[model samples]
Target chain A: MAKIFIIDDDEQLLRMVSLMLERGGHSTRLISNPVEGLQAVKEDKPDLLVLDVMMPGMSGHDIARDIRANKGLENLPILILTARAQEIDRETALKSGANDYLSKPVTSQELIEKVDELLSQPNQKMMPDRGVIIGMFGLRGGVGQTTLAVNLASALRRISQQEVCLVDFSPSGGQVALHLRLQLRHSWLDLPPLADLDWLALKGNLTLHPSGLRLLAAPQVPQLATEPSPEMAAKVIDLLQKQSAFMVIDVPRLFGPAFMAMMERVDIALHVLTPDVISVQTAVQLNRLLEKSNLKFKQKSYILNQVQVDSQIPQATVEKGLNARVASKINFDPNQARALSQGVPLTLTSAKSPLATMMNRMAEVINNRVAKRSGD
Target chain B: MGATHFGRNQLIHMDMFTDAYRVTGRVLVGAGGIHAELANPSSSFLELKDAYISRIHQPGEIVTHYKVAAFSKDNINFIVLQDRREGIPVGTQHGRSIYTRGRALSVFLTVPSFEISGEIMHDGKVAPREILVQSVGRYQLVFSAKALASLYPQISYSGDLILVQKDRIGIFCLDG
Candidate 1:
C-alpha cells in the first residue's frame, strides 16, 4: 500500500479524507496546519501529499508553492484542494506548482480516484534517465522475450506518447513477427546494401505502422549470409532515429557483430532470466561479460521473465547474486503463452492482464527516462 | 515562420504549412494602449474596419480573440487599438458579430487568419480601430473605414506578438 499525507485545517474534512484514503488500502498522515504539514513532508517524506487550499497560518497554495520550489520536493505530486473552481484560479494554482487542483466539497470517490491516479502515474522520481534496454534469452529456447518485448512496447506506448521502435534483430530466432502476429513485410537482410541505406530508403524499407510507429523485422530466411554488421547496426540505429524516436532492438542472445553493435548504443541493458538456476547463472555470466566491457550498460540487471508467483529462488537471493536491482518481476500468467501463440502483444490484446501490466510498468520506467532527458 | 497574435496571452505562429499566400503580422495595439510598429519589412500600409475583440473560443483550428474591422477605401489607413479588460468567448462574440451582420476575421491565435490587400496604412489612426472597453465585464466595439484598394492583389501573413501593458491581451493591427 502507498503512503499518503493530507494537510488541511478543517478537522472534519481531514478526518473524512483520512478515512477515505484508509479505506482505499493506503496509509495516511493528516495535518491540520500547513506549516506542520510542510515539516512532516520534509521529515517523513510520504509517497504522496494532498494539500488543502484553505488552511490556518499558511494557505495550501502557499505550502504547495513552497514544496514545488524546494529542489528535494519539486517532483512530488501535489493535489491542491480549493473552494473556488474559477478557471483563472485553477490556472494560477497550476502555475504555482500544483500537479492537480480540486474544488472543495469534493466527494470521497473523487478524492480516492485522484489519489489513485497520481500514485499509478510512475513517480517522476522512479523514472530512469535513459531507456533501459532489456535483452531476453532462454536457457534451452522459447523463453518468450519477443512477446514480452512487443507487450512491453505497447504498454509503454499507452503510458506516454514517446515513439517506440521494435526491431526484430534476432538472427535466426527472430520471432517478433510471429509474436506480433503481423506478416513480415521486409527484414534487414532484404535491406539494400548498407551504402545505399539513407533516411528515404530506410523509411521505404521499414513498414510505417498505422499506429504511427515503425518496426524492423529480422530476415525470415534461416542460415543465410549477408547479416547486418555491427557497423550496419549502428548505421541502422542512426537512420532509425531519423525515421522515428526510441527503439527496442530484439537482439540475438548469442554474441555477434549485430549484438555487440546494438549493445554499444543501448543505455540500460536488461538481461532476461527465468526461475531456473541455469538461467540465473547465465545471467550472472552475461552481467560479468558486460562489466568486462567497462560496464557498458549503466543499470544492468536480469528480468525474471515468466517467473511463477511461488518461485524456488526468492527475489532477494537473485538480487544479491546479480549485484543489480531486480528492476522488474513478471509473474507467469496462463494467458502469456496463449497471447504469444496467438501472435498478439499482450499489452494490446490483453492490457488488463497482470503480466502485461507489469511489463508496461517496466516500459514506463524506461520511457520516463527518455522523456526527462529530452525535456532537459 | 509567420505568427498571428490572438487576444493577449496567446501567440500563434505558422511554421507548418508552406505557401506564399501565408498571413504574417503582429497586433501592436493591445492592453490599455496602442503601440504597434511593423518590425519586419519595416512598414504596414493595410487598413481595417469594424474591429472588435470577441469573447468566444473557437473550437476547431482557429482559436482567436477576433478583431473585426472594415477596410478604408485606399486600404492604407492602418489603425491599431487595445481592448484590455473586455472578456468575450469566441462563440458569443462571433455570434454577436453575425447577428450584427459584420464582416469578421477569425484570428487563429496559433496562426494567421486574414490576408490584406496591399498598400495598407501604417499609422494607428487611418484604419478603423475597435477598442474593447471594460474592466471586468464583457465589451466589444466597431470602427469602420472606407475601402482603400479594391484593385490590389490579396496577400496573407501570419504572426503573433506579445503585447506588454497594464492589462495583458493579444493585439491585432490592420492596414488598408
Candidate 2:
C-alpha cells in the first residue's frame, strides 16, 4: 500500500478523506495544519499528497508551490482538493504545481481514482550531480540495442528535464544519429586531439535535436572516422560529464580496447538481447567475461528487447542461460516500426501506448538503479 | 464481563464542536458507544487523544494540539460521528430495537456559529419540541447530518451522526 500524506484545515474533511483512502488499502498521514504538513512531507516522503485549498496560515496552493520548488520533492504527486469548484480556482491550483485538482465533497470513487492514477505515474527525479553514464551493447545487430539507447536517452531528457546525450560510439556507419533523424553534419570525427581540443571544439561535434537531446554521432563512412584512443575517449567523457546529466552510449558489436574502456566508464552497462538461443549464449559469455576478466566491470545486466513477436525462445530459458535476471523487458512494440521510420523514440511519443509506457518505465528503473548504486 | 465487553478499543476520528471552538482528534471508544461515554452523567469531561484545537471561525488552521485532552461536556454543542450507531447508546443499538418502527423525520437546528440539518428517528408523534423535551439524555442523536457554517455555507460537513446537546440548540425545526 502507498503511504499518502493529506493536509487540510477541515478536520471533518481530513478525516473523511483519510478514511476513504484507507479504505482503498492505503496508509495515510493526516495533518490539519499546512505548515506542519509541509514539514511532515519533507521529513517523511509519501507516494502521494492530498491537499486542501483554504487552510489558515498556509494555503494548499502555497504548499504545492513550495513542494515544487524543493529539490527532491519537485516530482512528488500532489492532488489539490478545494471547496472552490470554479474553473479559475482549478487553473490556479494546477498553476500552483498540483498534479491534479478536485473540488469539495469528492465521492469515494473519484478520490480513490485520482489517487490511484497519480500513484501509477512515474514521478521522475533529478539525476545525481556527478550524473550516470549508461552504455548499451549487443554482440550482434537487430537486437534493439540502438533502440534502447535512443529511447533511454529521450526518456531521461524528457522526464528529468536534464541534459542527456546519446553517443553513437560505433566506429563506423552507426544508426544512432539516423534513429533521432539528425543529419550526418558532424560526428566525433570533428574533434581534434585531446590537448588541442577545447570545450567549443568538442561541443561542435555533438548534434542537437529539437527535443533538446544531444548526440555524438558516428561518421557515416567508417574510412573517414578514426576511433579515438582510450586516453582521448576518457578526455571526451570527462568533458561530456561536465555538461550532460546522463550520457547513453550505443556501443558497437565488438569488444575492442576502446570499447572496453567505454564499458569501464559506464555507471550501468546494458546488454540488449532478443529472445533467441544465439542472443542468450552471447549474453552469457559477455556477462561472465565482464565479471571474470581484468575489465571486471559490474555490468552483468541484460535487457530483453523482444524484437520478435513470437517464434522466440522462452524468457525463462534466456535467463537460465545468462545466469542472471533480465533487468527489464522491452516488449515487442508494433509501434517500433513507425518510431524507427520517423526517427522518434517510442518514449518520445505523447500517446500512452503499451510500448511507450514500457520504455518510460524501463528508463525509470535504470535511472533508479544507478541512483541506488551511486548512494552505495 | 468488562474484559469481554469493554476491553477492545475503537480508534475513530471525530470532531467535537463547542460554542466557541472546534476540537478534533482520535478518540478511543469502548463497547459502550461514544454517545454513551459522553452522555454518562457520572463523567464530567470527555477524553480526546491527539487533540487539535481551532477557533470556530478559522476552522482550517490549528491553534494548538495536545497529546491528550479533556473537554467539559457542558461546553460542546455537538460531536460529529462517523458511525451512526456510535451516536446511539450501547444497550439500545441495532438488534435490540425498542421501537417497532420509528418514523424518520427531517430536522434542522442551530448551534452558536453553525446550522445543522439531519433526520431524527422517534416512535412518538412527529413533534419537534417533544424530541428534546421528552428526551431523558442531554445529547440528542441526529443521523446523516450536515453542519454548514452560518456565514459561509460553502464550508459544510456531512457526518453519519451529529450528537447534539439539547441545551446548546438556539433554534429547532422539524419538517412534518
Candidate 3:
C-alpha cells in the first residue's frame, strides 16, 4: 500500500478523499492548509500527492510547482483533484507539473483507478551517489543565462526523470525565482554563516519549483553584498550534489570567490553568449580567463543565444573570434516573454516551440555525459 | 525568398513590441513561404531580423528597412523599401527571413540508481556487498551482481543480476 498525501481546503472533500483512498488500501494524510501540506510532504516523503487546484493561500498549482522544485521530492507522483473542471484548467494543472489531473466529485472507483495507475507506474530510480554540476554563466546581461538555467533544469528533470537543483548565484537581483514565480519564504540569505551551515541548514534554505527543480535563490534584496565564500560555496555545492542527480547553477556576471568556487566544482561550464558584438567580446575574454585560471572542469562549451530579433554579429563571426564552435544555438520565440511574464517556463508553456526543443536537446546531451561519467 | 501575399481583407491583431518594432495581428509563417502584405506602416521603415538577415547585413548596415508602416495592438501595415521605390505592393518573404527571439539549449537523462554498500541477506546469512539497487518495471528491486563482485571479492555470485524480493533483503545503509 502506498502512502498518499492529500491537500485540499475543503474539509468535507478532504475527508471524503481520505475515505476513498483508505478504502483502496492506501494510507492517507490530509491537510487543509497548503503551506502545512508542503512542510508535511517534505518530511513525510509520501508515495503520491493528491492536490487540489484552488487553495486559499497557496493554490494547488503553486504547491505542485514548489514540490516539483524540491530535489528530494522531484519524482513524487501528483494527482490534481480540483472542482474547476474546464479543459484549460486540466491543461494548466498538468503544465504546472502534476502527473495526473482528475476533476472534483470523482467517483471512488475513478479516484482509485487513477491513484492505482499513478502508483503502478515505474518510480524514478534513486539518485546516484555522485551528482553532476552544470554551471550557466554569461558575462553580458540579457543573454538569457537565467532563462536557460531555469529551462535547462526543467528540461533535465523531464528528460532524466531525476532530481535537478538550480542554484541562483547572481550577486545582485537574480531572476531565477522571479522566472518561476516562486514566492520566497526562504533563500540562501536565511542560512547562517558558512562555518555554521550543515546539510539541514542548507536544505531548509531552498525554494522548490513545481517543475521538479529545486532553486537556491539569491537574496531578494542585496544586503552587505553577502555572498557565499569560496569554501562555503564549494561545501554547499558538494552537499547539493550529494542530494541531487544534477546541480544546474546560474552563475552571476561578477567574477568573485563564489563564482570561482562554483566553476571549480562544475562538471561543465556553459558560457552563454548572444549574436552581438558586446556579448561575443565578453565571451572571448571569459574564455581567456578560464584558460588562464588554475580552476578545472571536465568540459567547457559556448552556447549562442538569440535573445533579440536583430543580430549585431553573425554566428560565424562569433565562432571565428572566440576560436570555439558554438555548441548550441537557441532560436528566438515570442512566447518566451509571455511565459516569463506569466511565471511559467516556455518549456512547459510551449514544449513544441523550437526554443523548447533546443533546450530538450541540450538536456539530452548533459544526460548522456552524466551517464558516461557514471559508467566510468 | 519572395514576398507572399496574405488575404487582402484579413485584419490581424498584434500586441507584442520590441524597441525597434511592434508586432500587430497574428501572422503564422510556416516552413513554406506565403504571399502576404502589410496594409499600413506604423513607421517610415520596417526592419526585419532573422538568421538570413543577420548573416547578410554588414557590421553597421540596417536589415529589412521599409517605408510607411503603421502598428497597433490589432493590426500592422508596412511597405518594403523595394516596393516603395518601385510603387509596387510589398509581399511576404521566406519564413526563415523573419526575426524572432533566441533560446538556450538544455539536456536531461534517466534518473540513475542509488549505489548502496552494505549488508544484505545472502543465503540466509548476513554479508557485506556493494550493490546497485534500482526499481524496475513498477516496484521490483534488482541488484547488480557485477557491482557486488567488483566491490566485494570475498562474496561469489554466479549470475550477473539478482531480483530481490521484498522479504529477501536485510538492513543496509543507503549512503554506505
TM-score of each: 0.50, 0.49, 0.45
Candidate 1 all-Cα RMSD: 16.6
Each prediction's DockQ? 0.01, 0.02, 0.01
What does candidate 3's lDDT look like per residue over A82-103, in tens digits?
A: 6444344565676677777886
Which tens-of-lDDT digit does each residue in B54-160 have in candidate 1? 11121111112223332221222222122211111212423532212334332211112322221211212233233223211221222221111122222121112
lDDT tens per residue, model 2, B1-176: 12214456676667888877777766777665676677677889989876767676666555776778999989889988655654554243355343214778899999888899998777787777777876547887788888887976766666778888988899999996
Return the TM-scores of chain A for each candidate in numbered order.
0.67, 0.64, 0.64
Lowest lDDT 10-mer window, candidate 1 chain B?
B14-23
Ranking under lDDT, best-scoring first?
Answer: 2, 3, 1
The alpha-carbon deviation from the true structure for residue A51 of candidate 1, after best TM-score superposition, in angstroms, is 8.5
- Candidate that beats the other on lDDT, 1 or 3, i.e. the better one: 3
Residue A82 lDDT in candidate 2:
72
